[model samples]
Target: MTKKRHAEIAGAGFAGLAAAAALGQRGWSVRVHEMNSELRAFGAGIFIWDNGLRVLNAIGAYLDVRNGAFAAPAYETRTDGKCLSFQAINGPGQYRLLTMTRQHLHAAMVKAALAAGAELVTSSEAVGATPEGELLLADGSRLPADIVLGCDGVRSRVRDSLAIPQERNKYKDGIIRVLTDRTGLKGGEWDHVIDFWAHSPRTLRILYTPSGENDLYMAMMAPVADTEASSIPINPAPWIECFPQLAPALTRLGDRGRYDVYETTKLPYWSVGRVAIVGDSAHAMPPTLAQGAGCAITNALGLAVALEETDTVEAALELWEKRERPLTDHTQRRAAEIAASRVLASGMKWDDEGLRAARHIPTGAAMPFVDAA
Candidate 1:
């Protein structure tokens, strides 16, 4: 009998967990290492587009995600308190989009990965990795496997250890995200994801996303130079003056809100020998397209499929990068372009050229054995 291939993955974020589930389902021995004492997800809410939904379904996590997610009927944009554009998101020929708290998505992924027989080790920090298929941990030990994956966010120690040439760029704009209850909130299109922009008297933006039935996720965006608008324990005065419609929600912002400056990390290649980088570690891009998690999950599943088709680990890594990188690069470039513009033109549609990846079918989604159970 052939020995089971083993994979050691760093990080328990969307990329790492998705990889775990995909490989484990294919009968590979998988272990995921996370630095935290417990697995948890940061941020308030997340958008899962059609591509991401397809991946979740393939991994058997879609049912759980759908149970707790909100499917928005439309996406709307407003500028200076006037409607700029409104596009139906759930219409015929449109792809599926769901909004949910980051925690909900993470939990569903965790369940799916564990059910696939992947082991999760928390509080075990992977500091780096070797091209020889060894994972270096913080406690002065190395774990060897058939493959090593670096899904460890933008500052991936694994990618750095391999000396991969890369460029990291930080944009001037950032967002402060917070989640508040939807109870008693009145007089607004609560079912749509709304983007409110204020270009004058200091640029400010709000991305209103409804998550599930009780929660509302609001992302307040501004240039990092505008200290008042970007600060935590948010000052509601200016925001209220600009978007009085969200005054009730803005006033409910708590101390847990954190401002994150948008950043993008680009890499020429994703792997070296038996070690490979996935997700943000390989391609972190601006949130303008909201494809960060979508791309991460999609590529993770694609990596598993590539490995299954090839006998040599190096060949699989090369094939995975060749197949997945182009679309991801295009998405990143388009996201950067939109972020640079910082303005959504009137009548802008979500299904434009910028969303090519959303319409893509991942490598293993169509396989009969993917979700066979």
Candidate 2:
């Protein structure tokens, strides 16, 4: 017989789909709602570390994630074209550092959730949610469940409905990504490993990661002192000067332009009663750590594991929050530290014990140095 407990997930992002898939594997009936008519990824590149991959394996989708993804062994940090350190992602040829398009990952998760028997409804228009798992849709219809997982993102309507108090601040700058394919980069124990470069006195930072054979992903972020700085179209020297190896790639990037950046305050708590917030709704850190999606995946993993350990939804949610909070708090703080500086902020060399503070394969490359905020 099917269990009476049901989990309603708001948002069809990596976090929501992950939670649905994980819960379904644990014998819970799951349904997911996305306001959009179609499920899609952000059209960017994302790095998934071991922690996230472990969670995907728990739900039996690790290989699905591996499909259409690149296997990157290590990530390097450089300044003035000098290698400061090279951090191995998973070790040689292992499933270590990896990159995939947002769309690919989204499709993979959708497949995993459906395979686990999770019902998904797009264009459902979730306007709000209740602590007892009732979701009010745009059509004035209400759906009931045993629990709700709000993965609605930074401006989550579910989080607002919960009256979850939060603080948000905008960054003076943003990032723009340029996909560079087939640099034909090879050889060196670190051939084709991730490249992160910063300048001395550090005003610009640049990063390069191979998406697949002959294809690379590039991101450039910088601080904006002037509101119209993006429109000004200044020289690239400040950001790319330290890494001459990228001269050709920078020219290829050719001013793809800018996007806005912002981060929210880490919430005081992740859940209220049976409804809990996961992913960015719970803790949003700057992209400097690249843990946003990875952490969200972990939150889904934690919530599902907690449910399997207890009989009640409330107990499970509480346990999940309790177990995941410290690590998330640590992640947020460390990312903030990176965002707070411009002088080559690489935590890769942190003492072994301090590694927990680093997010999985986090790197912010090719952007303007962040001025003190």
Candidate 3:
């Protein structure tokens, strides 16, 4: 008979689904609760790097992820149309960077989880969780499990329920994304790469990749000093005005005039006792590094391995933290540095100290400039 481990996961985004798939494959019975009645219909794309692909392959979904995505060999960093860094993603056994819509990828993960014996329930937002292992649903229902995992987004109800508010470091100014029917971008290998444009006091990053129907996915970010986290208009006229050269590209975006942007924070710890958090619930960094999703994969894989190694849920949780925290901490720091640098790049605000910091930086060191908080 197969071993039976019952797990309750709150939130069914990429992280939740990935955790469910990993545990279910290990003879665990998994149930995922999500707030939406159906998976999200629209969202921008995520670029999965080699480390992420390696984890996906562990759960047998890397092939599917690669098939549904377009490949890019490298990412470029530019300022005032001048290339400052060109980092290649070439290495032994390195899978090409894959880009695709979050919705499509979420659906793919959900399908994989179900195939691995995970039950996913939509429209079931988790209102609270306890260290003793109980999940409170929005509808006033309760679930008892051996472990509770939170994969909710940045504004996670589960994280709040656990009374583990995230620790704030840097706040998000804004992020905008639009799907368009445009293509044919130029300069420095545009087959499937992400371009990050840095201006002093402002940072603009864009990811462009074909979505397999002659459509392209675009996600951009800019600094917002006046707007609240959720106050950005669906069509942000001001943010677009910052990147005129990319205006034609934005014009080809979706019918919406603005893209969605929001703030982010990082929790000091991703877990307590039998309850743990992953993804945005644990660490929500800027897209500057494009590793937000990649971080989730790392957390999920770490949790999976920890659980597999120990019979006690609490032990697994502790092991999970021990293994994942350093990596996450490194990721968060990198993100902050990159975001700070990008903000400087957009406007050429380099003090003597800034110029000193910029000089002699290694090319690979410039790739993500992202760290997990």
Give one digit per residue, the lDDT tens place, for model 1 in 225-322. Answer: 98888887788888888888888788777676888898889998899889989999999998888899999999999999999999899999999999
**Superposed Cα deviation of residue 298, candidate 2 (Å):** 1.1
Between prediction 2 and prediction 3, which has the larger lDDT?
2
lDDT string, candidate 3, 1-373, tens digits: 7658789998888888889988888888999998888866356666676567666666656667666676656655566567665545534554346677677677778778988999989889898898888888988888988889888888888788778766666644556666665455543465545464645334455544555444567666655653521233444454355556556666655454353444357776778777888888888876655677877866886787788898788888877888677666666666666665555344322233322211222111223322224
Global CA lDDT computed for model 2: 0.71
Evaluated at residue 13, the lDDT of candidate 2 is 96
Candidate 1: worst-modelled 10 consecutive residues by lDDT: 364-373
lDDT of 2 by residue, 279-327 (tens): 9888888776667788888878778878888878889877887878888
Best-performing candidate as measured by TM-score? 1
Cα deviation of 80 in candidate 2 (Å)? 2.6
Error of 1 at 196 (Å): 0.9
Off by over 4 Å in 1: 186-188, 345-347, 367-373
My TM-score estimates for the predictions, one after another, are: 0.96, 0.84, 0.81
lDDT value, residue 37 of candidate 2 = 81
Q: lDDT for model 3, please.
A: 0.67
Candidates sorted by TM-score, best first: 1, 2, 3
